[model samples]
Target: MKQIIEKKRTLGLLLVILGASFWGIGGTVAQRLFQQDNIAVEWLVSSRLLLAGILLIALYKITHRQASIFVIWRTKQTAFRQILFSLLGMLAVQYTYMMSIAIGNSAVATLLQYLAPLFIMAYYLLTRHSALTRQDGIAVTLTLVGTFLLLTNGSFSTLSVPFMAVFWGILSGLSLAFYSIYAVPLLQQFHSLLVVGWSMLIGGTVMSFFHQPWLIDLSTWTFSTVLYYLFIIIFGTMLAFWFYIASLRYLSPKEASLLGSLEPLTAVITSVWWLKISFGGYQFMGTLLILLMILYLTVFQKKQRER
Candidate 1:
């Protein structure tokens, strides 16, 4: 029994790490597509969500042959909620994040998205009448200082990151917060795959109407471009999500979240090395502060649970 549990935990750790790494690398891949191929963000977002959604639903069907994929839409209330989640949560998050990457480097975009937790913290404080904990305050201060340094390179006179990129990046963070918070009730009612799958499909379908990705010219795409596109949809979006969710079967949510810090770290490394994005001393310090904020919150959460 002990060995079995240990093996499961190990598997969980591997899955979560793989999942987060895939996501991190995926952002860099998407940036390459935008920079080299001039691929439209709308088309990529629609294509990725549509295909990934179909694949996930299919996987769920294969694994749980007895379960119904349509169960999430059985009631009107649920159907509405699912549609809203698909549009406002999944689609919004994806579109905004991709826009951020298109406008800036993946490293900055991803780090900005990590601000989702802080937004959630603020939301609860405002809406739920929750008291501010010391740890929360510290984490907020660290993130704010980190963000300022990242954007300004520790100088008040100039902005290191583009203003438009920062605009989209902050929006991406807010959208991510919404995505995480709004999905809770639906997640409680259905399997994560089911909820996520439907949301993706719905969001993709809606985006397809607007972008018409099928109409895009494929003749201009090189072989490598085609391969990169496939990698984004299959390995990055689909497998990343699958691995992360599967990890939850063996690890606690807090543990999984703590492991998720790897996503930004991987993004930063790949962006700096592969994309040749600059990472100056101030930016490095900013990154460390942000990461430290994440670590601090994780410890705080663990202590809160213990208490």
Candidate 2:
């Protein structure tokens, strides 16, 4: 029984890590696409949510064999909150992240955006009535140090960061933090897929007015672009999200946050391989520090469970 449970935990961790890795690929693809067309950042963000939302809704209907578009009128209050969370947490974080990339470097944007874990820990401590452990504090400290290293371009010099970029990065982190905490209760109440799918649908619908998808030049779409877009929708949005929820079924919120720390590491590795980008010694050290912190938290949690 003990071995089986350990195996399940291992499997869940692996799924979350894999999902983060897939999510990591978005930066590289987005960079390539945006460089080619220089499309409005809002449009890019809105289009992704709108299209991905539609795809997810279709997928949910097919997989669940349920009626598409169940009337959610009675749950309007909760649904409204979900929509707000999705828009601010999902849509806003995504948009700000892209804006960070636009205004700063990809590596910097990624590292800064990952400050979500810190915000998540804080949220849990304050609102969830959870006790703050020493390990949690250490993990948060390490993550912050790693972020500082990345932001300073590995030189420990803060002079290079632009004012607006910093603002966007911080905002992105806050949004992600809020999402991580709030989404947990909502997920407990509804299927993760349903919550995510519906939130995406609502948020996407709201964004459509700004993105103006009807103006998209469908005729100009190349096979490669279409392939990239489909990859984002299916692997990035749907499958990765499903894996995330599955992991949450087995792990605590803090454990999930620790696992999610893999996202930035995966992004770094993917960027190196796919984009041939390299990091400096300090950057590598920072990444290692963050990974070590997450490992410590996971190991500590396991020890507590055993005791």
Best by TM-score: 2
Shift in Å, residue 232, candidate 2: 1.9
The alpha-carbon deviation from the true structure for residue 126 of candidate 1, after best TM-score superposition, in angstroms, is 2.0
For candidate 2, the 10 contiguous residues with the lowest summed lDDT are 150-159
Tell me the tens digit of each residue's lDDT in model 1 across 1-307: 7678667877877887898789878877887888899899999999999999999999889999999999988999999998987888788878888877777756467667767757777787788746667765776677667765654467755535687887888888887677656666776688878877887788899999999879788889999999999999987888876676666667644345445556766666787898887777897887788678656654565567456
**Candidate topping lDDT:** 1
Q: What is the lDDT of residue 107 in candidate 1?
A: 49
lDDT for 26 in candidate 1 is 86
lDDT of 2 by residue, 153-196 (tens): 46645435677787888788787676666677676666666667
- The runs of at least 3 residues in candidate 2 whose Cα sits more than 4 Å from the true structure, single-residue gaps closed, are 1-12, 66-73, 147-153, 157-159, 218-221
Q: Find the 10 residues in a row with the least total lDDT in model 1.
A: 252-261
lDDT of 2 at 79: 66
